[model samples]
Target: MGIILEINGFKYFAPLSSFKPKHKRLCETIDFIKVGIYAVINLNNMFPAPLNLCKAVQIENIKNEHYRNLVRAKYRIIKQKTEQIVNNAKDVYNHKMINDGKSKLSQRCNDFRNLELKCKEYSDKKK
Candidate 1:
C-alpha cells in the first residue's frame, strides 16, 4: 500500500489494481493512474489506513519468482513517481470532498472525509 500526502495529518493508502478489460477502454485521469498494461493505481479506492495497522511486505520472501519480479518492477515504477502519486492522491481527496458524489469518480471513491473520522475514532479507541 502507498500513502497519499497527509490529509488533515492523516495518511491514506491506495492499492495498485490489476488492469481490467474495462480499464483499457477508459483514459487515465487524476483519480486513475495507468501503470502501462500491468496495473492501474485506482485513487478512487483510497482510504485512511493507519500506519500501525500496515505491515511491511517482505518482497524477498516471496516464493514465486514471476510474482516477486512483477512486484519489484511495479515498486520501482511507483517509487520513481512518489511525488506525482502523492500529489494525485491529494487531488483525488480534494476532488471527492468537493464533488460529494456529484462526479462519477466520487461515487466510486471511498468517502474520504468520513473515513478520516472513522480512522480517528479507531485510533482513539485503541489508545
Candidate 2:
C-alpha cells in the first residue's frame, strides 16, 4: 500500500507500511505510487528527427540573420562617416592651398567636385 499527499501545491508520497501505528491523522491522501510511469513510456517518441541537427539549423538561421544585419549596418555607417570626414579634410586642405598659393582655385574646385561624385556613387550603391 502507498499514500500520496498534496499540501500547498507540493506533493509528498510514502509507502503505507512506513506510517507508524500511533499516527492517526492524515489531512488528505491518495494512492499514486508511480508518478514517473507515463513519462518513461512517452519520452522515447518525443523527438522524431536527430536533435542535434534540428538545433543546429535553428541556431544557424538566427545567427545568420543577426550577423547579416549587423554587417550591413556597419558598412553603411562607415561609408557615410568616412565620406563626411574626407569632405571636411578636403575643405581644410583647399583653404591651406589657397592661402599658401600652392594650387589655383580651379584645381581645388575640381578636387571638391570629384569628392562630391564619389559620395553620390556611394549613395547610389546603397539604394
Candidate 3:
C-alpha cells in the first residue's frame, strides 16, 4: 500500500511495488522537458518564477543519476539559450551606461565653457 500527494496543484501519483522502472523513466522524461522549457523561456534568470513556471524549471534540476547524462544533454541546450539572453542584456546595459556617461560629460564641458566666457567678459570690463 502507498499514498499519493499533490503540491501546488501538481499531481503525484505514487504507487507501491517500489515504483517500477518504467514509471521512473517516464518521470525523468517529464522532468527534462518541463525544466528545459522553463529555463529557456525565463532566460532573464527569473527562476523559481510562478508556480507553473517553477514546475517547469524544477524539471531541469531533477536528480536522477540513472538518467544523468541524458538530463545533462537537455540542460546544455537550455543553458545555451539562457546564456545568450544574459549576454544580450549585459550588452544593452553597457551601451546605455556608456551613452549616459558621454551625455553627462558633454553637458559638463558646455557648462565649463560658459563659465570661461563669463570670466573673460569680467576681465574685459576690468581692463
Candidate 4:
C-alpha cells in the first residue's frame, strides 16, 4: 500500500514486505530494494493502482510510536531512492514487453502491459 511509482502513464503501487529470513539470503536486485532490515520493496509485484482506488496512509493515526517511526524511516529511504525505483520499474516493464514475458525476470514480474490495459478500462468506466 506504499510507494506509488508512475511508469508509462500508469501509477504503480509496489508492495513493501517485511524482511523475512529468506530475504537475508537473497541479494537486492534492480526490482528489489532493502530498507534496512525492516522491509523490502518488491517492484516485481507492483500493480497499477489508480488514485481513486488508493488511500493515503495517515502516519499520525498510527498509535504505536515504534510503528510510526519505522514507517517514517522507511519513507525516508524510499524518497532517496525514488529515481532508481522509477528507472528500474521502467526497465522491468520494457524488458517484459520486449521479450514477450519469456525471461526469468519477466516471469517474476506482474503482467504490466495487461494491467495497464485493465487500468485504462477502469478509467473509461469512470468517464
Candidate 5:
C-alpha cells in the first residue's frame, strides 16, 4: 500500500512499507488524506540555510520562455550595433587608405580583410 501526497503542485508517492509503524498509524487516522495530504511537513522550517553562489546564479538563469526570448533579442540587437560600428570603421579606414595611395590594391584589400577578422574576433569574444 502507498500514500500519495500533493505539495507545492507536485505529487509524491510514499509507500506504507517505507514508513515506520507509528508513522503509518498517524497517517491512517487522517480523514482528508484520501482527498489530499496537507501540512505533513513545513518546508520553510526544514531549510534555514542559504544557497551557494553557483546555485543562486543557476537558479537566476532559469527564466521562462518569454524572458529567454527577450534576452536573445537583446543580444541580437547589440550584435547588430557592433557590426554596424565595425562596418563604419572599415569604410573610414578604406577611404583614408585610398586618399594616401601608399599601399598597393592587394595590400589595401588584405588590410580590410584583417580589420573584418578582428571585428569578428571581438564579436565572438563578446558572445
Candidate 6:
C-alpha cells in the first residue's frame, strides 16, 4: 500500500515497498506508526516549496548562461545597423557641404535629414 499527501495542488505518494532500510526495519518492528511517520517526512520533502526552490535555482542558472549572450548579440546587431545609417547620413552631409550651388546643397541636406529621421523612426519602432 501507499500513502498520499496533497500539497499546493500537487499529489505525492510514498509506497510502503519503497521505504529506506531504516524505515523498513522500523516498519517491521513498529509497523504502521513508523511507516506513517516516514511517509509524512517523505511527502513533506516532496512538497511545492523545495520543488519551486529548485526550479528558481535552475532559472537563475539559465539566465546567467544564455540570456547574457543573447542580449549582447541583440545590442551588437542594433549598434552595427545604427552605425551604418549614421555613416550614410554623414556621407550625404559631406556631399551637401562640398556643393557650391544653393539648390543642390538644399536637396542633399533634405536627403540627409530624411535619412536621419527615418533611422530614428526605425530605431524607435524597434524599441
Alpha-carbon lDDT, every model: 0.81, 0.31, 0.34, 0.85, 0.33, 0.35
Q: For residues 30-123, what per-residue lDDT tens digits would candidate 5 score against the true structure? A: 1111111212221111111111211212323747877565445434443454444334333434443464446443233324333445545655
Q: Per-residue alpha-carbon lDDT of model 1 for 2-107, expressed as tens digits?
A: 5345666897778778878999989978888877677888888888878888777788998999999887887777788777778888888888889998989789
State the lDDT of candidate 6 residue by residue for 52-78, as single tens digits.
Answer: 212211223446756555434433443
Top candidate on lDDT is 4
Model 5 residue 127 distance off true place after TM-score fit, in angstroms: 27
Please give the range of 10 consecutive residues that has the lowest summed lDDT in model 2. Answer: 38-47
How far out, in Å, is residue 43 in model 1? 0.5
Clash pairs, candidate 5, are none
lDDT of 5: 0.33
Local error of candidate 5 at residue 76 (angstroms): 0.8
TM-score of predicted model 1?
0.87
Off by over 4 Å in 6: 1-78, 100-108, 111-127
Q: Candidate 2 residues 6-125, lDDT tens each?
A: 222222222223223333333211111112211111110111121122221123344677755644443344345444433433443445335544544333322333343554565566
Ranking by TM-score: 4, 1, 3, 6, 5, 2
Misplaced by over 4 Å in model 4 are none
Candidate 6: worst 10 consecutive residues by lDDT? Answer: 40-49
* lDDT over C-alpha atoms for residue 60 of model 2: 30
Query: What is the per-residue lDDT of model 4 for residues 1-127, given as tens digits with 9 covering 90 to 100?
Result: 4788887888888889998989988887888888777889888899998888888889889999999999988888888888888888888878888877588888898888889899999999999
Candidates' TM-scores?
Answer: 0.87, 0.18, 0.22, 0.92, 0.19, 0.21
lDDT of 5 at 57: 21
Q: Residue by residue across 12-119, what tens digits does model 3's lDDT show? A: 221222233444344322111223322222111111112221223344466886556555655565455444434443433334334543653232222322333554
lDDT of 3: 0.34
